[model samples]
Target: MTSFFATRLAVFSTLLLGGLSTAWLQAGENPDPLGEKTGGSTTVYASGKNAFSFPLASLEDEERTRFVIGNSFFKRNWVEAPASTTARDGLGPHFIARACASCHSLDGRGAPPDWSRTLGPEPDATVALLLRLSVPGKPAAHEGVVPEPNYGDQLNNAAIAGVKPEGRVEITSQSIHGRFADGTPYTLQQPHYRIVDLGYGPMAPDVMISPRIAPQLAGVGLLEAITEADIEGNARAQAAAAGPVKGQVNHVWDAFAKAERVGRFGWKANVASLAHQTAGAFNGDMGITSSLFPQEGCTAVQIDCLAAPSGCPAKGKTDKAGKAPEIDDDTFGQVVFYQAALAPVARRQAKDPQVLRGQALFAQAQCIACHRPSYVTGEGPFPSLTSSKLSRQRIWPYTDLLLHDMGPALADGRPDFQANGQQWKTPPLWGVGLIESVNGHQRLLHDGRANGVLEAILWHGGEAKPAQQKVLKMSLAERQALIKFVESL
Candidate 1:
C-alpha cells in the first residue's frame, strides 16, 4: 500500500484497536476490534422491534427535541390544498404514498407484498415500495434513463382527488430451487412486474422498470457523512483486484450541488446526498413539493394533474398565499435532521464463537471484495443533520458505496446514471439482521425476492459470482457460521 493508504490504515487501526480481539481468528483478524459497533460510540441499543427510529444517544437535548417534532411530519399524511390544514396541504398531482412513513414504515424497510396472503396497501399509497420507470436514451443523454414522456420517471399507482392516476403496478412470481453443498434445498422467488391501468396512455415502446423497496433509515446521516475520497478509493482498489469483483462509481444529479456527483444512496446509488434523497421523496413519493423540488410532479399529458393545487406563494409574500412549497424549508430540513440523527442498531452477538468463525469464513470467501466492512467518514458540510463525533469516525457499514455487476439473475436491465443494468451499489449490512424485527418480514435484495440472508447470498453473481461459488461449496456448518457472523452485525 502507498503512504496515503498506509496512513488511512494507520488511522483506522488506531481508532479500532481495543474493544475486542480477533488475534486468534485468521480470516476475521482486523486491528479494528470495534467493527461491529458500526457507529462507534454513537451506536444505540434498541431491540429489532424498536429499531430504525431511535435517536443517537449522544445528541444534545435540543437536537433530541427536534427529532420528535420531525417524526410527526414524517408520519402524518398530507392533505389536498384549499383545506384548513395549510401547513401540510397540497397532496399529489400524482404520488406514491400519503407520507414518508407509508413506504418507510416505522422508519424500517417496506415489506414485500405477500401474494399468498392479502395484497398489501395500494402500491402507490406509501406501502413502502415503488417502481422506477425510464426508457433507453442515447449516450449523449448522460442523465441516465429517460423518463416516459407522459408519465415521468416513476410509476405512480395512486393520485390525489380529481386527478387521474398514472397507472397500476401488478406483480407475479415463479420459484427457483437449488441445493447447498450438503444437499439442503432452498428456493428463491423471481418477481415479474406488469404495468396496467394506464390512465394517460401507453408507455414508450420499450419502457424499463426497476422496483425498489424502502430501506431502513438508521445511520443514513453517517452514510452521507462518508467522504468522496474513500468511496472513490474503494472503486480504484477493486478495479485493480485480480479477482472478478471490479466495481464502478455512479455519477448522479445532486440538486444541492446543482451538478453530478458521486452517488452514495439508493439501490443504484442514483442519489448523492440525504437531502437530495429526502427532497426527491417529498416530490416523487408524496407529491408534496419542497423548496428543493418546487414544481408539481405532473407530466405534460396529464392536464388534470397539472391543475392540482400547489401551495405556491403569490407574486409577493402574503398570509393568504400558502407556503410556496407544500412542505416548508424548515419542516423539510427537520425531516432530514430526523433521518440523519436516527441511530444504527448496536450490533448483537459479536462475541459468539460461531459468529466469529463465520466472520473469518466470510473474509475467506472474498465477500469483502465488494461488501467492504469498514470506513472512516471525512469531515463534511452536513450541519445540524450531522453529529460532530461522527466526523472522522471509523464506522463499519459493510459496503463500498460503489456499483458492482451482480450478473444476470439480479439485473434490473435499467440504466441509472453511470450504473448499468447489472451493477448495483453494495447494500450496507450493518443493520441487515434487524430488518425482520423492524418490518416483520425478512425479504432481501432490491425487490425483496431473496427470502433471507442466505438466499440473498445465494443470488449473488457477476463480480460476486466467485464469492457465491465459494459459499455454495462450504459445508453447511461453515455456511451457517458465515451467516451467523453477518447476523451478529
Candidate 2:
C-alpha cells in the first residue's frame, strides 16, 4: 500500500509540475490578453479602490423593479404576474423555450446534459440550447491557410414536425486521457455534436459544425461600456507586447445597420449590440417576429416547425382584418433592459489564507489577461448606466470582450461572420459562484460541456492553452487556492 501510494503521488507531481510550468511560461509573455492598460484612467468610485466602480445600490434596484401595474406590464421572472397569457403569448413557432428566465433561470448560468438521464428520450432537455452553424471552406485571414469543414453546428432534436424540423441535432462526447504537467493522468471530456436535421435535406457530408452554450447575463452593461477604441487599442498592444496571448475583434453583420460591424455579443462575438442580439434570440431561438427578423420560419421545409396546431399568423395579419398590436418591442426591450442592468453578485469574500494566496497566483499566472479584473462604463441613456453613475461604480466582470483562438480541440468548426471556428468571446466570470445555486447545475463554457469551473479551465487550449498548462503544474494547495479564488468570483 505504501509503495502504491508513493507511485501515485510521484505521477501526480509530474503532471502538476508540467502543467504549471507551461502556464508560467505563457504568463511571462503578454499578460494583458484583452490589451487593456491602466495609465490615465481616473478612479471611478471612492469606496471601490479598483479600476471599475460598482453601483451596488442601483444594480440591486434594477433587479427588483417591475413594469407598471397592469396586465401588459413587464416584470422579472422572480416577480409574480396575474395573467397566464402574458407568459404564454411569447412562445414560438420555433422557440427553444418560453421566457428568458427559462434558459438563464434566475438570470444565471445553465447546466450541461444530465448523464443520468442520457439513455432516456430527452437527451438534452434540461440543458441550455446550443446554436449551430455550417459553411463552405474558406481562406484564413491571419494564418493565410485554407479552412476546413468538420461536422455541423447544433442538433435540433426538438422541432415542430410539420415544418420538417430542420436537421436532427445530436451530441457525442468522448473521454480522452491527458497527463497534466504534474504527471497526473486525468480524463478530459471532449464533445462533438453531429447535425442530422437539415431543413433543405442532406447537407454536404463534410459540412462544419459548431456548438455554443448560452452564457450568463449579469454584468453585460459593464462590458458594453468599454470603449471600442479601448478594445482595439488593447488588441494592438497585446500583439506588440511580449506575450503568447493574442486576441482579435470579430466584425459581423449588424442587422440594425444593414452592414457589418464590430461584434460585441455572442460566444463568437458575432453580434454588434444587445438590442440586435435580443432580436436575434426572438427570431432564431423562438421563431418570433421582430423588426429585425421579419420573416416567419419556413415550416414546409421544417416539419417540426409546423407541428403546432395553429401556424403563426403573418407578421402584420390578424384573424379579424384590423391592425394587430405591434410586435412587443418594448416588452422585449424591457427584458434586455433588465438583463443589461442585472447587477453582478459580490465576489466571494473568503478569509482563508490559502484562497488569498491563490488570488495572487491567479494574477501571476495571467488568468486575468482574458478575464480582466474591472472596467468603467461610459455614459448611456439609462440613469443607472449613465456616465455619472458609471464613473462612481467599480465592477469586476473578468473578461476582455474580445475573441481568441481556443485551439482545434475545442473548435466547433463553424464560422460566424468574421469569427473562425476556434474563436470565442471572453465570458465574464462575476456571479459565477452562485450559478449552481440559481440554476441547479454547474455546466460551464459556451456550450455547457465542462462539469465544473476546474474542468472549464482544464479544457482551455489555443490562446489559453498556456494558462491551462500552468494550472496543471501547481501544487495541490495552490490549485485549491486558484479554485477558491474562482469560486469567489
Predicted candidate 2 versus true structure: per-residue lDDT over 229-300, tens digit per residue: 656755775687677778888776676667656678888887876767777765555555566666444434
Instruction: List residue ranges in candidate 1 displaced over 4 A.
Output: 1-34, 116-126, 139-142, 312-323, 385-387
lDDT of 1: 0.78
True-vs-predicted CA distance for residue 78, candidate 2, Å = 17
- The all-Cα superposition gives candidate 1 an RMSD in Å to the true structure of 5.8
**TM-score of candidate 1 on Cα atoms, chains taken together:** 0.90
User: What's the count of clashing pairs in each model shown?
Assistant: 5, 60
Q: Judged by lDDT, which candidate is best?
A: 1
Q: Candidate 2 regions off by >4 Å? A: 1-56, 59-90, 115-125, 137-155, 160-162, 197-200, 256-260, 303-326, 381-392
lDDT of each: 0.78, 0.55
Instruction: State TM-scores per candidate.
Output: 0.90, 0.74
